[model samples]
Structures are given as structure tokens and as C-alpha cells.
Target: MADKNTQVQLARQPDGEPKVSDFQVAETDIPAAGPGKFLARNIYLSLDPYMRGAISGRHMGHSRLNQGDLIGGRCVAQVIESKHAEYAEGDYIVIESGWQSYCVSDGAAKDGVRKIDPNAGPLSAALGVLGMPGLTAWAGVEKLADPGLGDTFVVTAAAGPVGGTAGQLAKAKGCRAVGIAGSDEKCRIVVEEYGFDACVNYKNDDWEEALKEACPDGIDVYFDNVGGPILDTITQQLNLYGKIILCGLVSQYNRNDDNDFAGHNMGPFVGKRAQLLGLVVYDYYDQMDEFLRAAVPLVKAGRLNFHEDRADRIEDAPAHFAKLMSGQNVGKAMVTIGPESL
Candidate 1:
């Protein structure tokens, strides 16, 4: 067994996009499992766009992750040792161990740790379609948006894990699912593989018009992932009493001022009486298993499709993170650290 652990920490706050120098990898003695606790080795670390908010020091989340802080994130880990009754040695679980080789936990909090069934699809899926992103999509599309049969459901960032999962859920519920993505390739995959009724490439010159044609009856349920001009375009076509699931604002996450958050006519919202609901995935963590129960089968049965852009080592997290923020990755971004236990 290794006596020392390697960890990645935030070296500096990013000005715009994060660079490798913004992080530092350090070595320290691995923590011993305390009473009611266990030591787990991290296998996979999830690199998400939301982490940008943390790295840039601009988020309102529970933790503010500053310089020299151990960068926190969700991971798939295997229990190496345990002093806790609930967990045994070699137990594969999902945990918030951040960018470290190992973590010690007692499984006390809702977001801290939870055991996962190896049979529940691929182990990496725990950090992607069957994990936080999955739960976020479920809470946004099912619990909040509630799209019904024949409803027009549109999602921005449609090729991403959250948006893709939500679009598929909308389709499963008998809605006409439409997606808006950055590139034509992403849009193609969203429509052809994810079963979205249509997908519009926002990078195209006539994207706004294309979106208008895609949602002929107007958007009944809009899952807003990127809050920018695209949101303004979608808002213009919102049906009466249209539901808006405000899941994320990726487009404006890097901005440093109040001006970036402004603009977009609100007249449509007033005339249509759209319901806008902001989402924080942690609020629905308790119901994650409910999401897993629904998504795992779809994934296993090949009804739902997911994508991943992976790095082979932990040292590659920052670069891949930059790729994710710049919209270079095609799907869920992740890093494989330790070998995945079967």
C-alpha cells in the first residue's frame, strides 16, 4: 500500500480561462482512516464546466475554493481501508474527494459518499450520466420542467451531459425535443444519436431563424444551460405559461462584471408568463438514487446515449478543464487516475 498521496490544488485564481500554472500538484502522507471513517483511492475525477466558477472564485456555492485549497470535485473511488461499519474493504463508491489520489470520509453528509452497484452500467457513468449531471438533468426536466406529450422542449448546450440527458428525458416523455449546440457536428450527434427531434447549430449565421423553425409551435419547456444571446432567442418563442429550467449560465461564467449578466428583452417573459426556476443540483442530491434508477436502465438498454472526453492522468485535469470551458470537449469531461476496480 502507498504511504503517500498526491493531490492537485488551486495555485491561483484564473483571469479568464484556467491554465496549468493555476494549479499545483503536491505530495503528502495518505490520511489514515479514523473511527467511523474509511480511506478510499480515487479512480476517476470529473472535470466539469461548473468547476470554472470555483477556479475563478466567482461562485455562490457552499465552498469558495481559494488559492492553495484542494480543488474539490466528485470522483469514483474504491475503499482501501475502513473503520466504518457501513463500508467494507474494496467497496466501490462515489465520493467528493476532489483532485486527490485518496480521501477519508465517514459518509456522514448527503454529498460526501455513497456506494454504487457495479452492475449499474460503466463505473465512469457514476460521474457522468448516472451521477451529479444525471441528477441535475432529472431534477430540471422531470421534477421542475414537467414537459408533457406533444410539448416542445428545447435545451441549450444540448450536446453536453446535462443538456443531452434532459433532451433524451423529454423525448422519452413524448415531447418534441430540440437542441441548440455550438458546432454542426455536436448538433448532428444530438439529433441522430440522442433522438432529439431537431438540433440547431448556434455557430451558424442563421441560427436564430433555424431555432424559430425548429420550435414552430413555440417552446413549451426551455432548459437553459447557457445564458447569453441564445437564451434571449429562446425566450422570444416561449409559449404561454412556458416553463424555464435555469440550470446553468456557462456562457457568462467567465465574466468579471455585472454587465455580462445583463441584456435580453424580458417582454416575452411578461407576455408569456414563463416560469423561471433556478437549479442547484445539491438541492436534489437526496433523490439521486431515483435518477440512477431511471437513467441506468436507459443507458444499459441502449435507449439513452452519453459521451465522454477523458484524460489518462490526473495531471491533465487543468488542460481538459480548459478544453471544457472553451467548448472543445464533446461530452462529459473526466480524468482517469487509479485503475477502475471491477
Candidate 2:
């Protein structure tokens, strides 16, 4: 029988790189499932760059975690016990269960919890391609940038979950997709697995030249994931009426609060009448059902492909998260909890 009680707690605030000292594995009495609630065993935990923002209290909107409270994010879990009418024992669901091994959920009444179709593909995919990252790519492409057929699209962090999905989505729409990744392997993956038209290695000696050569017609849509020198370079290559979807700034996540970029080259925007727009994935939550309706079929038919770098233990979450921030993860960095068979 499941003990039904126990969890890991945050021990301290991290400075720069997080150490094991920042976390504490603890045991607590599992609270009972209340009216319209269910008990769940966490099977997978999502480790995203946005979690880093939440940890530092830099995220906008309602804070998901307190200083010493359980760190909250998306997780895939199995229902162990239930008082909720919509759920049954052994049902697989996605919820905001934090880093703990178990949780009590009130069905889909809460934000981020949903009954996922386990047969859609791998259950872990509920936290990756077929989940938030996939929706992010769909909304960014369909709503924000709106790349037309044969349009030249450029995306940074091309090997990561959102970027990889975005690149493939662009290709599916008959657009010329160019990806920018940190290493040669990731660049190759973007071209081969994601079907990107071209890939540029940001770490290469002539990255700017390579980008220019690949995008001869200039960039029609720029999906900005890693900002810094790449943003500056992409800004200079915008075609007339080009659009840039600002997804994230992983490149600046570790910067000191004092430092700021100034005097960015805006000449391309002015000359080409291009627009750079910021996009927070949650803003498009209203269209999530629409996105899932479209994307899930592709996933089910094996048309869409995705990758995950799984860390076997929940205790390894912080390290995996650090790797994600450092561009060390090739795809979605997720931590697997409990048994693997689930």
C-alpha cells in the first residue's frame, strides 16, 4: 500500500548556480482527498526554464510558490484515490503537483490540471511536445508570427522543446525554416528530425555569415527563444514586414540584475517595417483546446516527433534544471518519478 505521505522541500534560496544545499528531502503526512478531490502519485516532473524564473521570484503574475513552500510546476500523475466525479483510480492526469512525489488534486477545477489521453503517445509527452511546449509553438506560429507559405522563418534554441516544435510546424506549413542551436549535434537534429530547411551553429566561428547564407531572402518570421547576440544578429536580417515572436530569453537568465543591454540595432526594423512582439504562453491558454485538437492528431498519427532528456530521480531536478538554463539539454528536461512503467 502507498504510504500516501511524504515530499521534498526547498531548503534555501540559490545564488547563481544551485547546489544540493538549496533542497531538502522531507517526509510529511499526506493530506486526505477532500470533496471533489483526488490523490495522485507523480510519475513525471517537468523542468523548464520558466521554473527558474519562478524560483527567483522574477515571474510575472501570481507567484506559484512561497520561499519554503513546495516548488510548483506541471507534472504527470496517476490517480491513487479519488472523491472527484470526473476521475477514477489508475487514471492518468496532468496537474500542477510541484516537485513532490504525490499530490491531491481537485480535478480540472484548478489551473494546469487536465485529463490527458494516455493512448495519444507516451505519457511523459504530456509534459513536453503534446503539452505546453507544443501549444507554445502552435500559438506562436499560428497567431503571433503568422508565417506565410514559403516564408523564411528563423528560430533560436532550435534543439529545445518549443524551438524544435516551432521549426517543424513552420516546415509543415511550407515555410523555409532555419534553426539556430548551440552545438553541431543539435543543429543536425534540427535539420534531420525536425525537418528544418537549414540550421546554424551559434557556437561556430562564422555564425552571422552562416545565417546570412542560409537566409538569402532574409528572415520573414523570427522566433526568439535565446536572446543576446543572436537577437542582435536576427534583428539585422529581417525582411520587409517581418515579424518576431519573442518566446524567451534563456541567454540572459543568469545575468546579474545590474547589467542591461542598450542601443540594440533597430535599423532593420525601421527599414523593413518589421515588428517584434513578446509572447507569454499562458496568454494563449484560451486557445489551448483548439491547439490540442490540432496538434494531438498529428502526434497520434506519428507526424509530429519530439525528444526528452529524462533524469531518473526527482532529486536530480535541480541539476537538470541547471543544465536546461545552460543550454545543456537537447530537448525538454524532465524528471521521472516513481516507477518507469507508468
Which candidate wins on lDDT?
A: 1
lDDT of 1 by residue, 192-237 (tens): 8898999999889998899889989989999999988778778888
Task: Compose the digit string of candidate 2's lDDT tens values, residues 1-342.
Answer: 356444656677666655567667666777688999898888999988876667767677535354567776788988888998989988888898888788887766454778888887789988888888888998899988888899999999898889999988888888999999999989988888877889999898999999999999988999999877778778888887889898998876665352544446777668778788888888887887898888888777766778789998877777777788777898889998877344
Global fold similarity of model 1 (TM-score) = 0.95
Cα lDDT for residue 221, model 1? 94
Candidate 1 residue-wise lDDT at 57: 55
CA-only RMSD, every prediction: 1.7, 2.1
lDDT of 2: 0.82
Off by over 4 Å in 2: 1-6, 62-67, 108-111, 256-263, 340-342
The residue pairs that clash in candidate 2, if any, are: none
Q: Give lDDT: candidate 2, residue 185.
A: 89
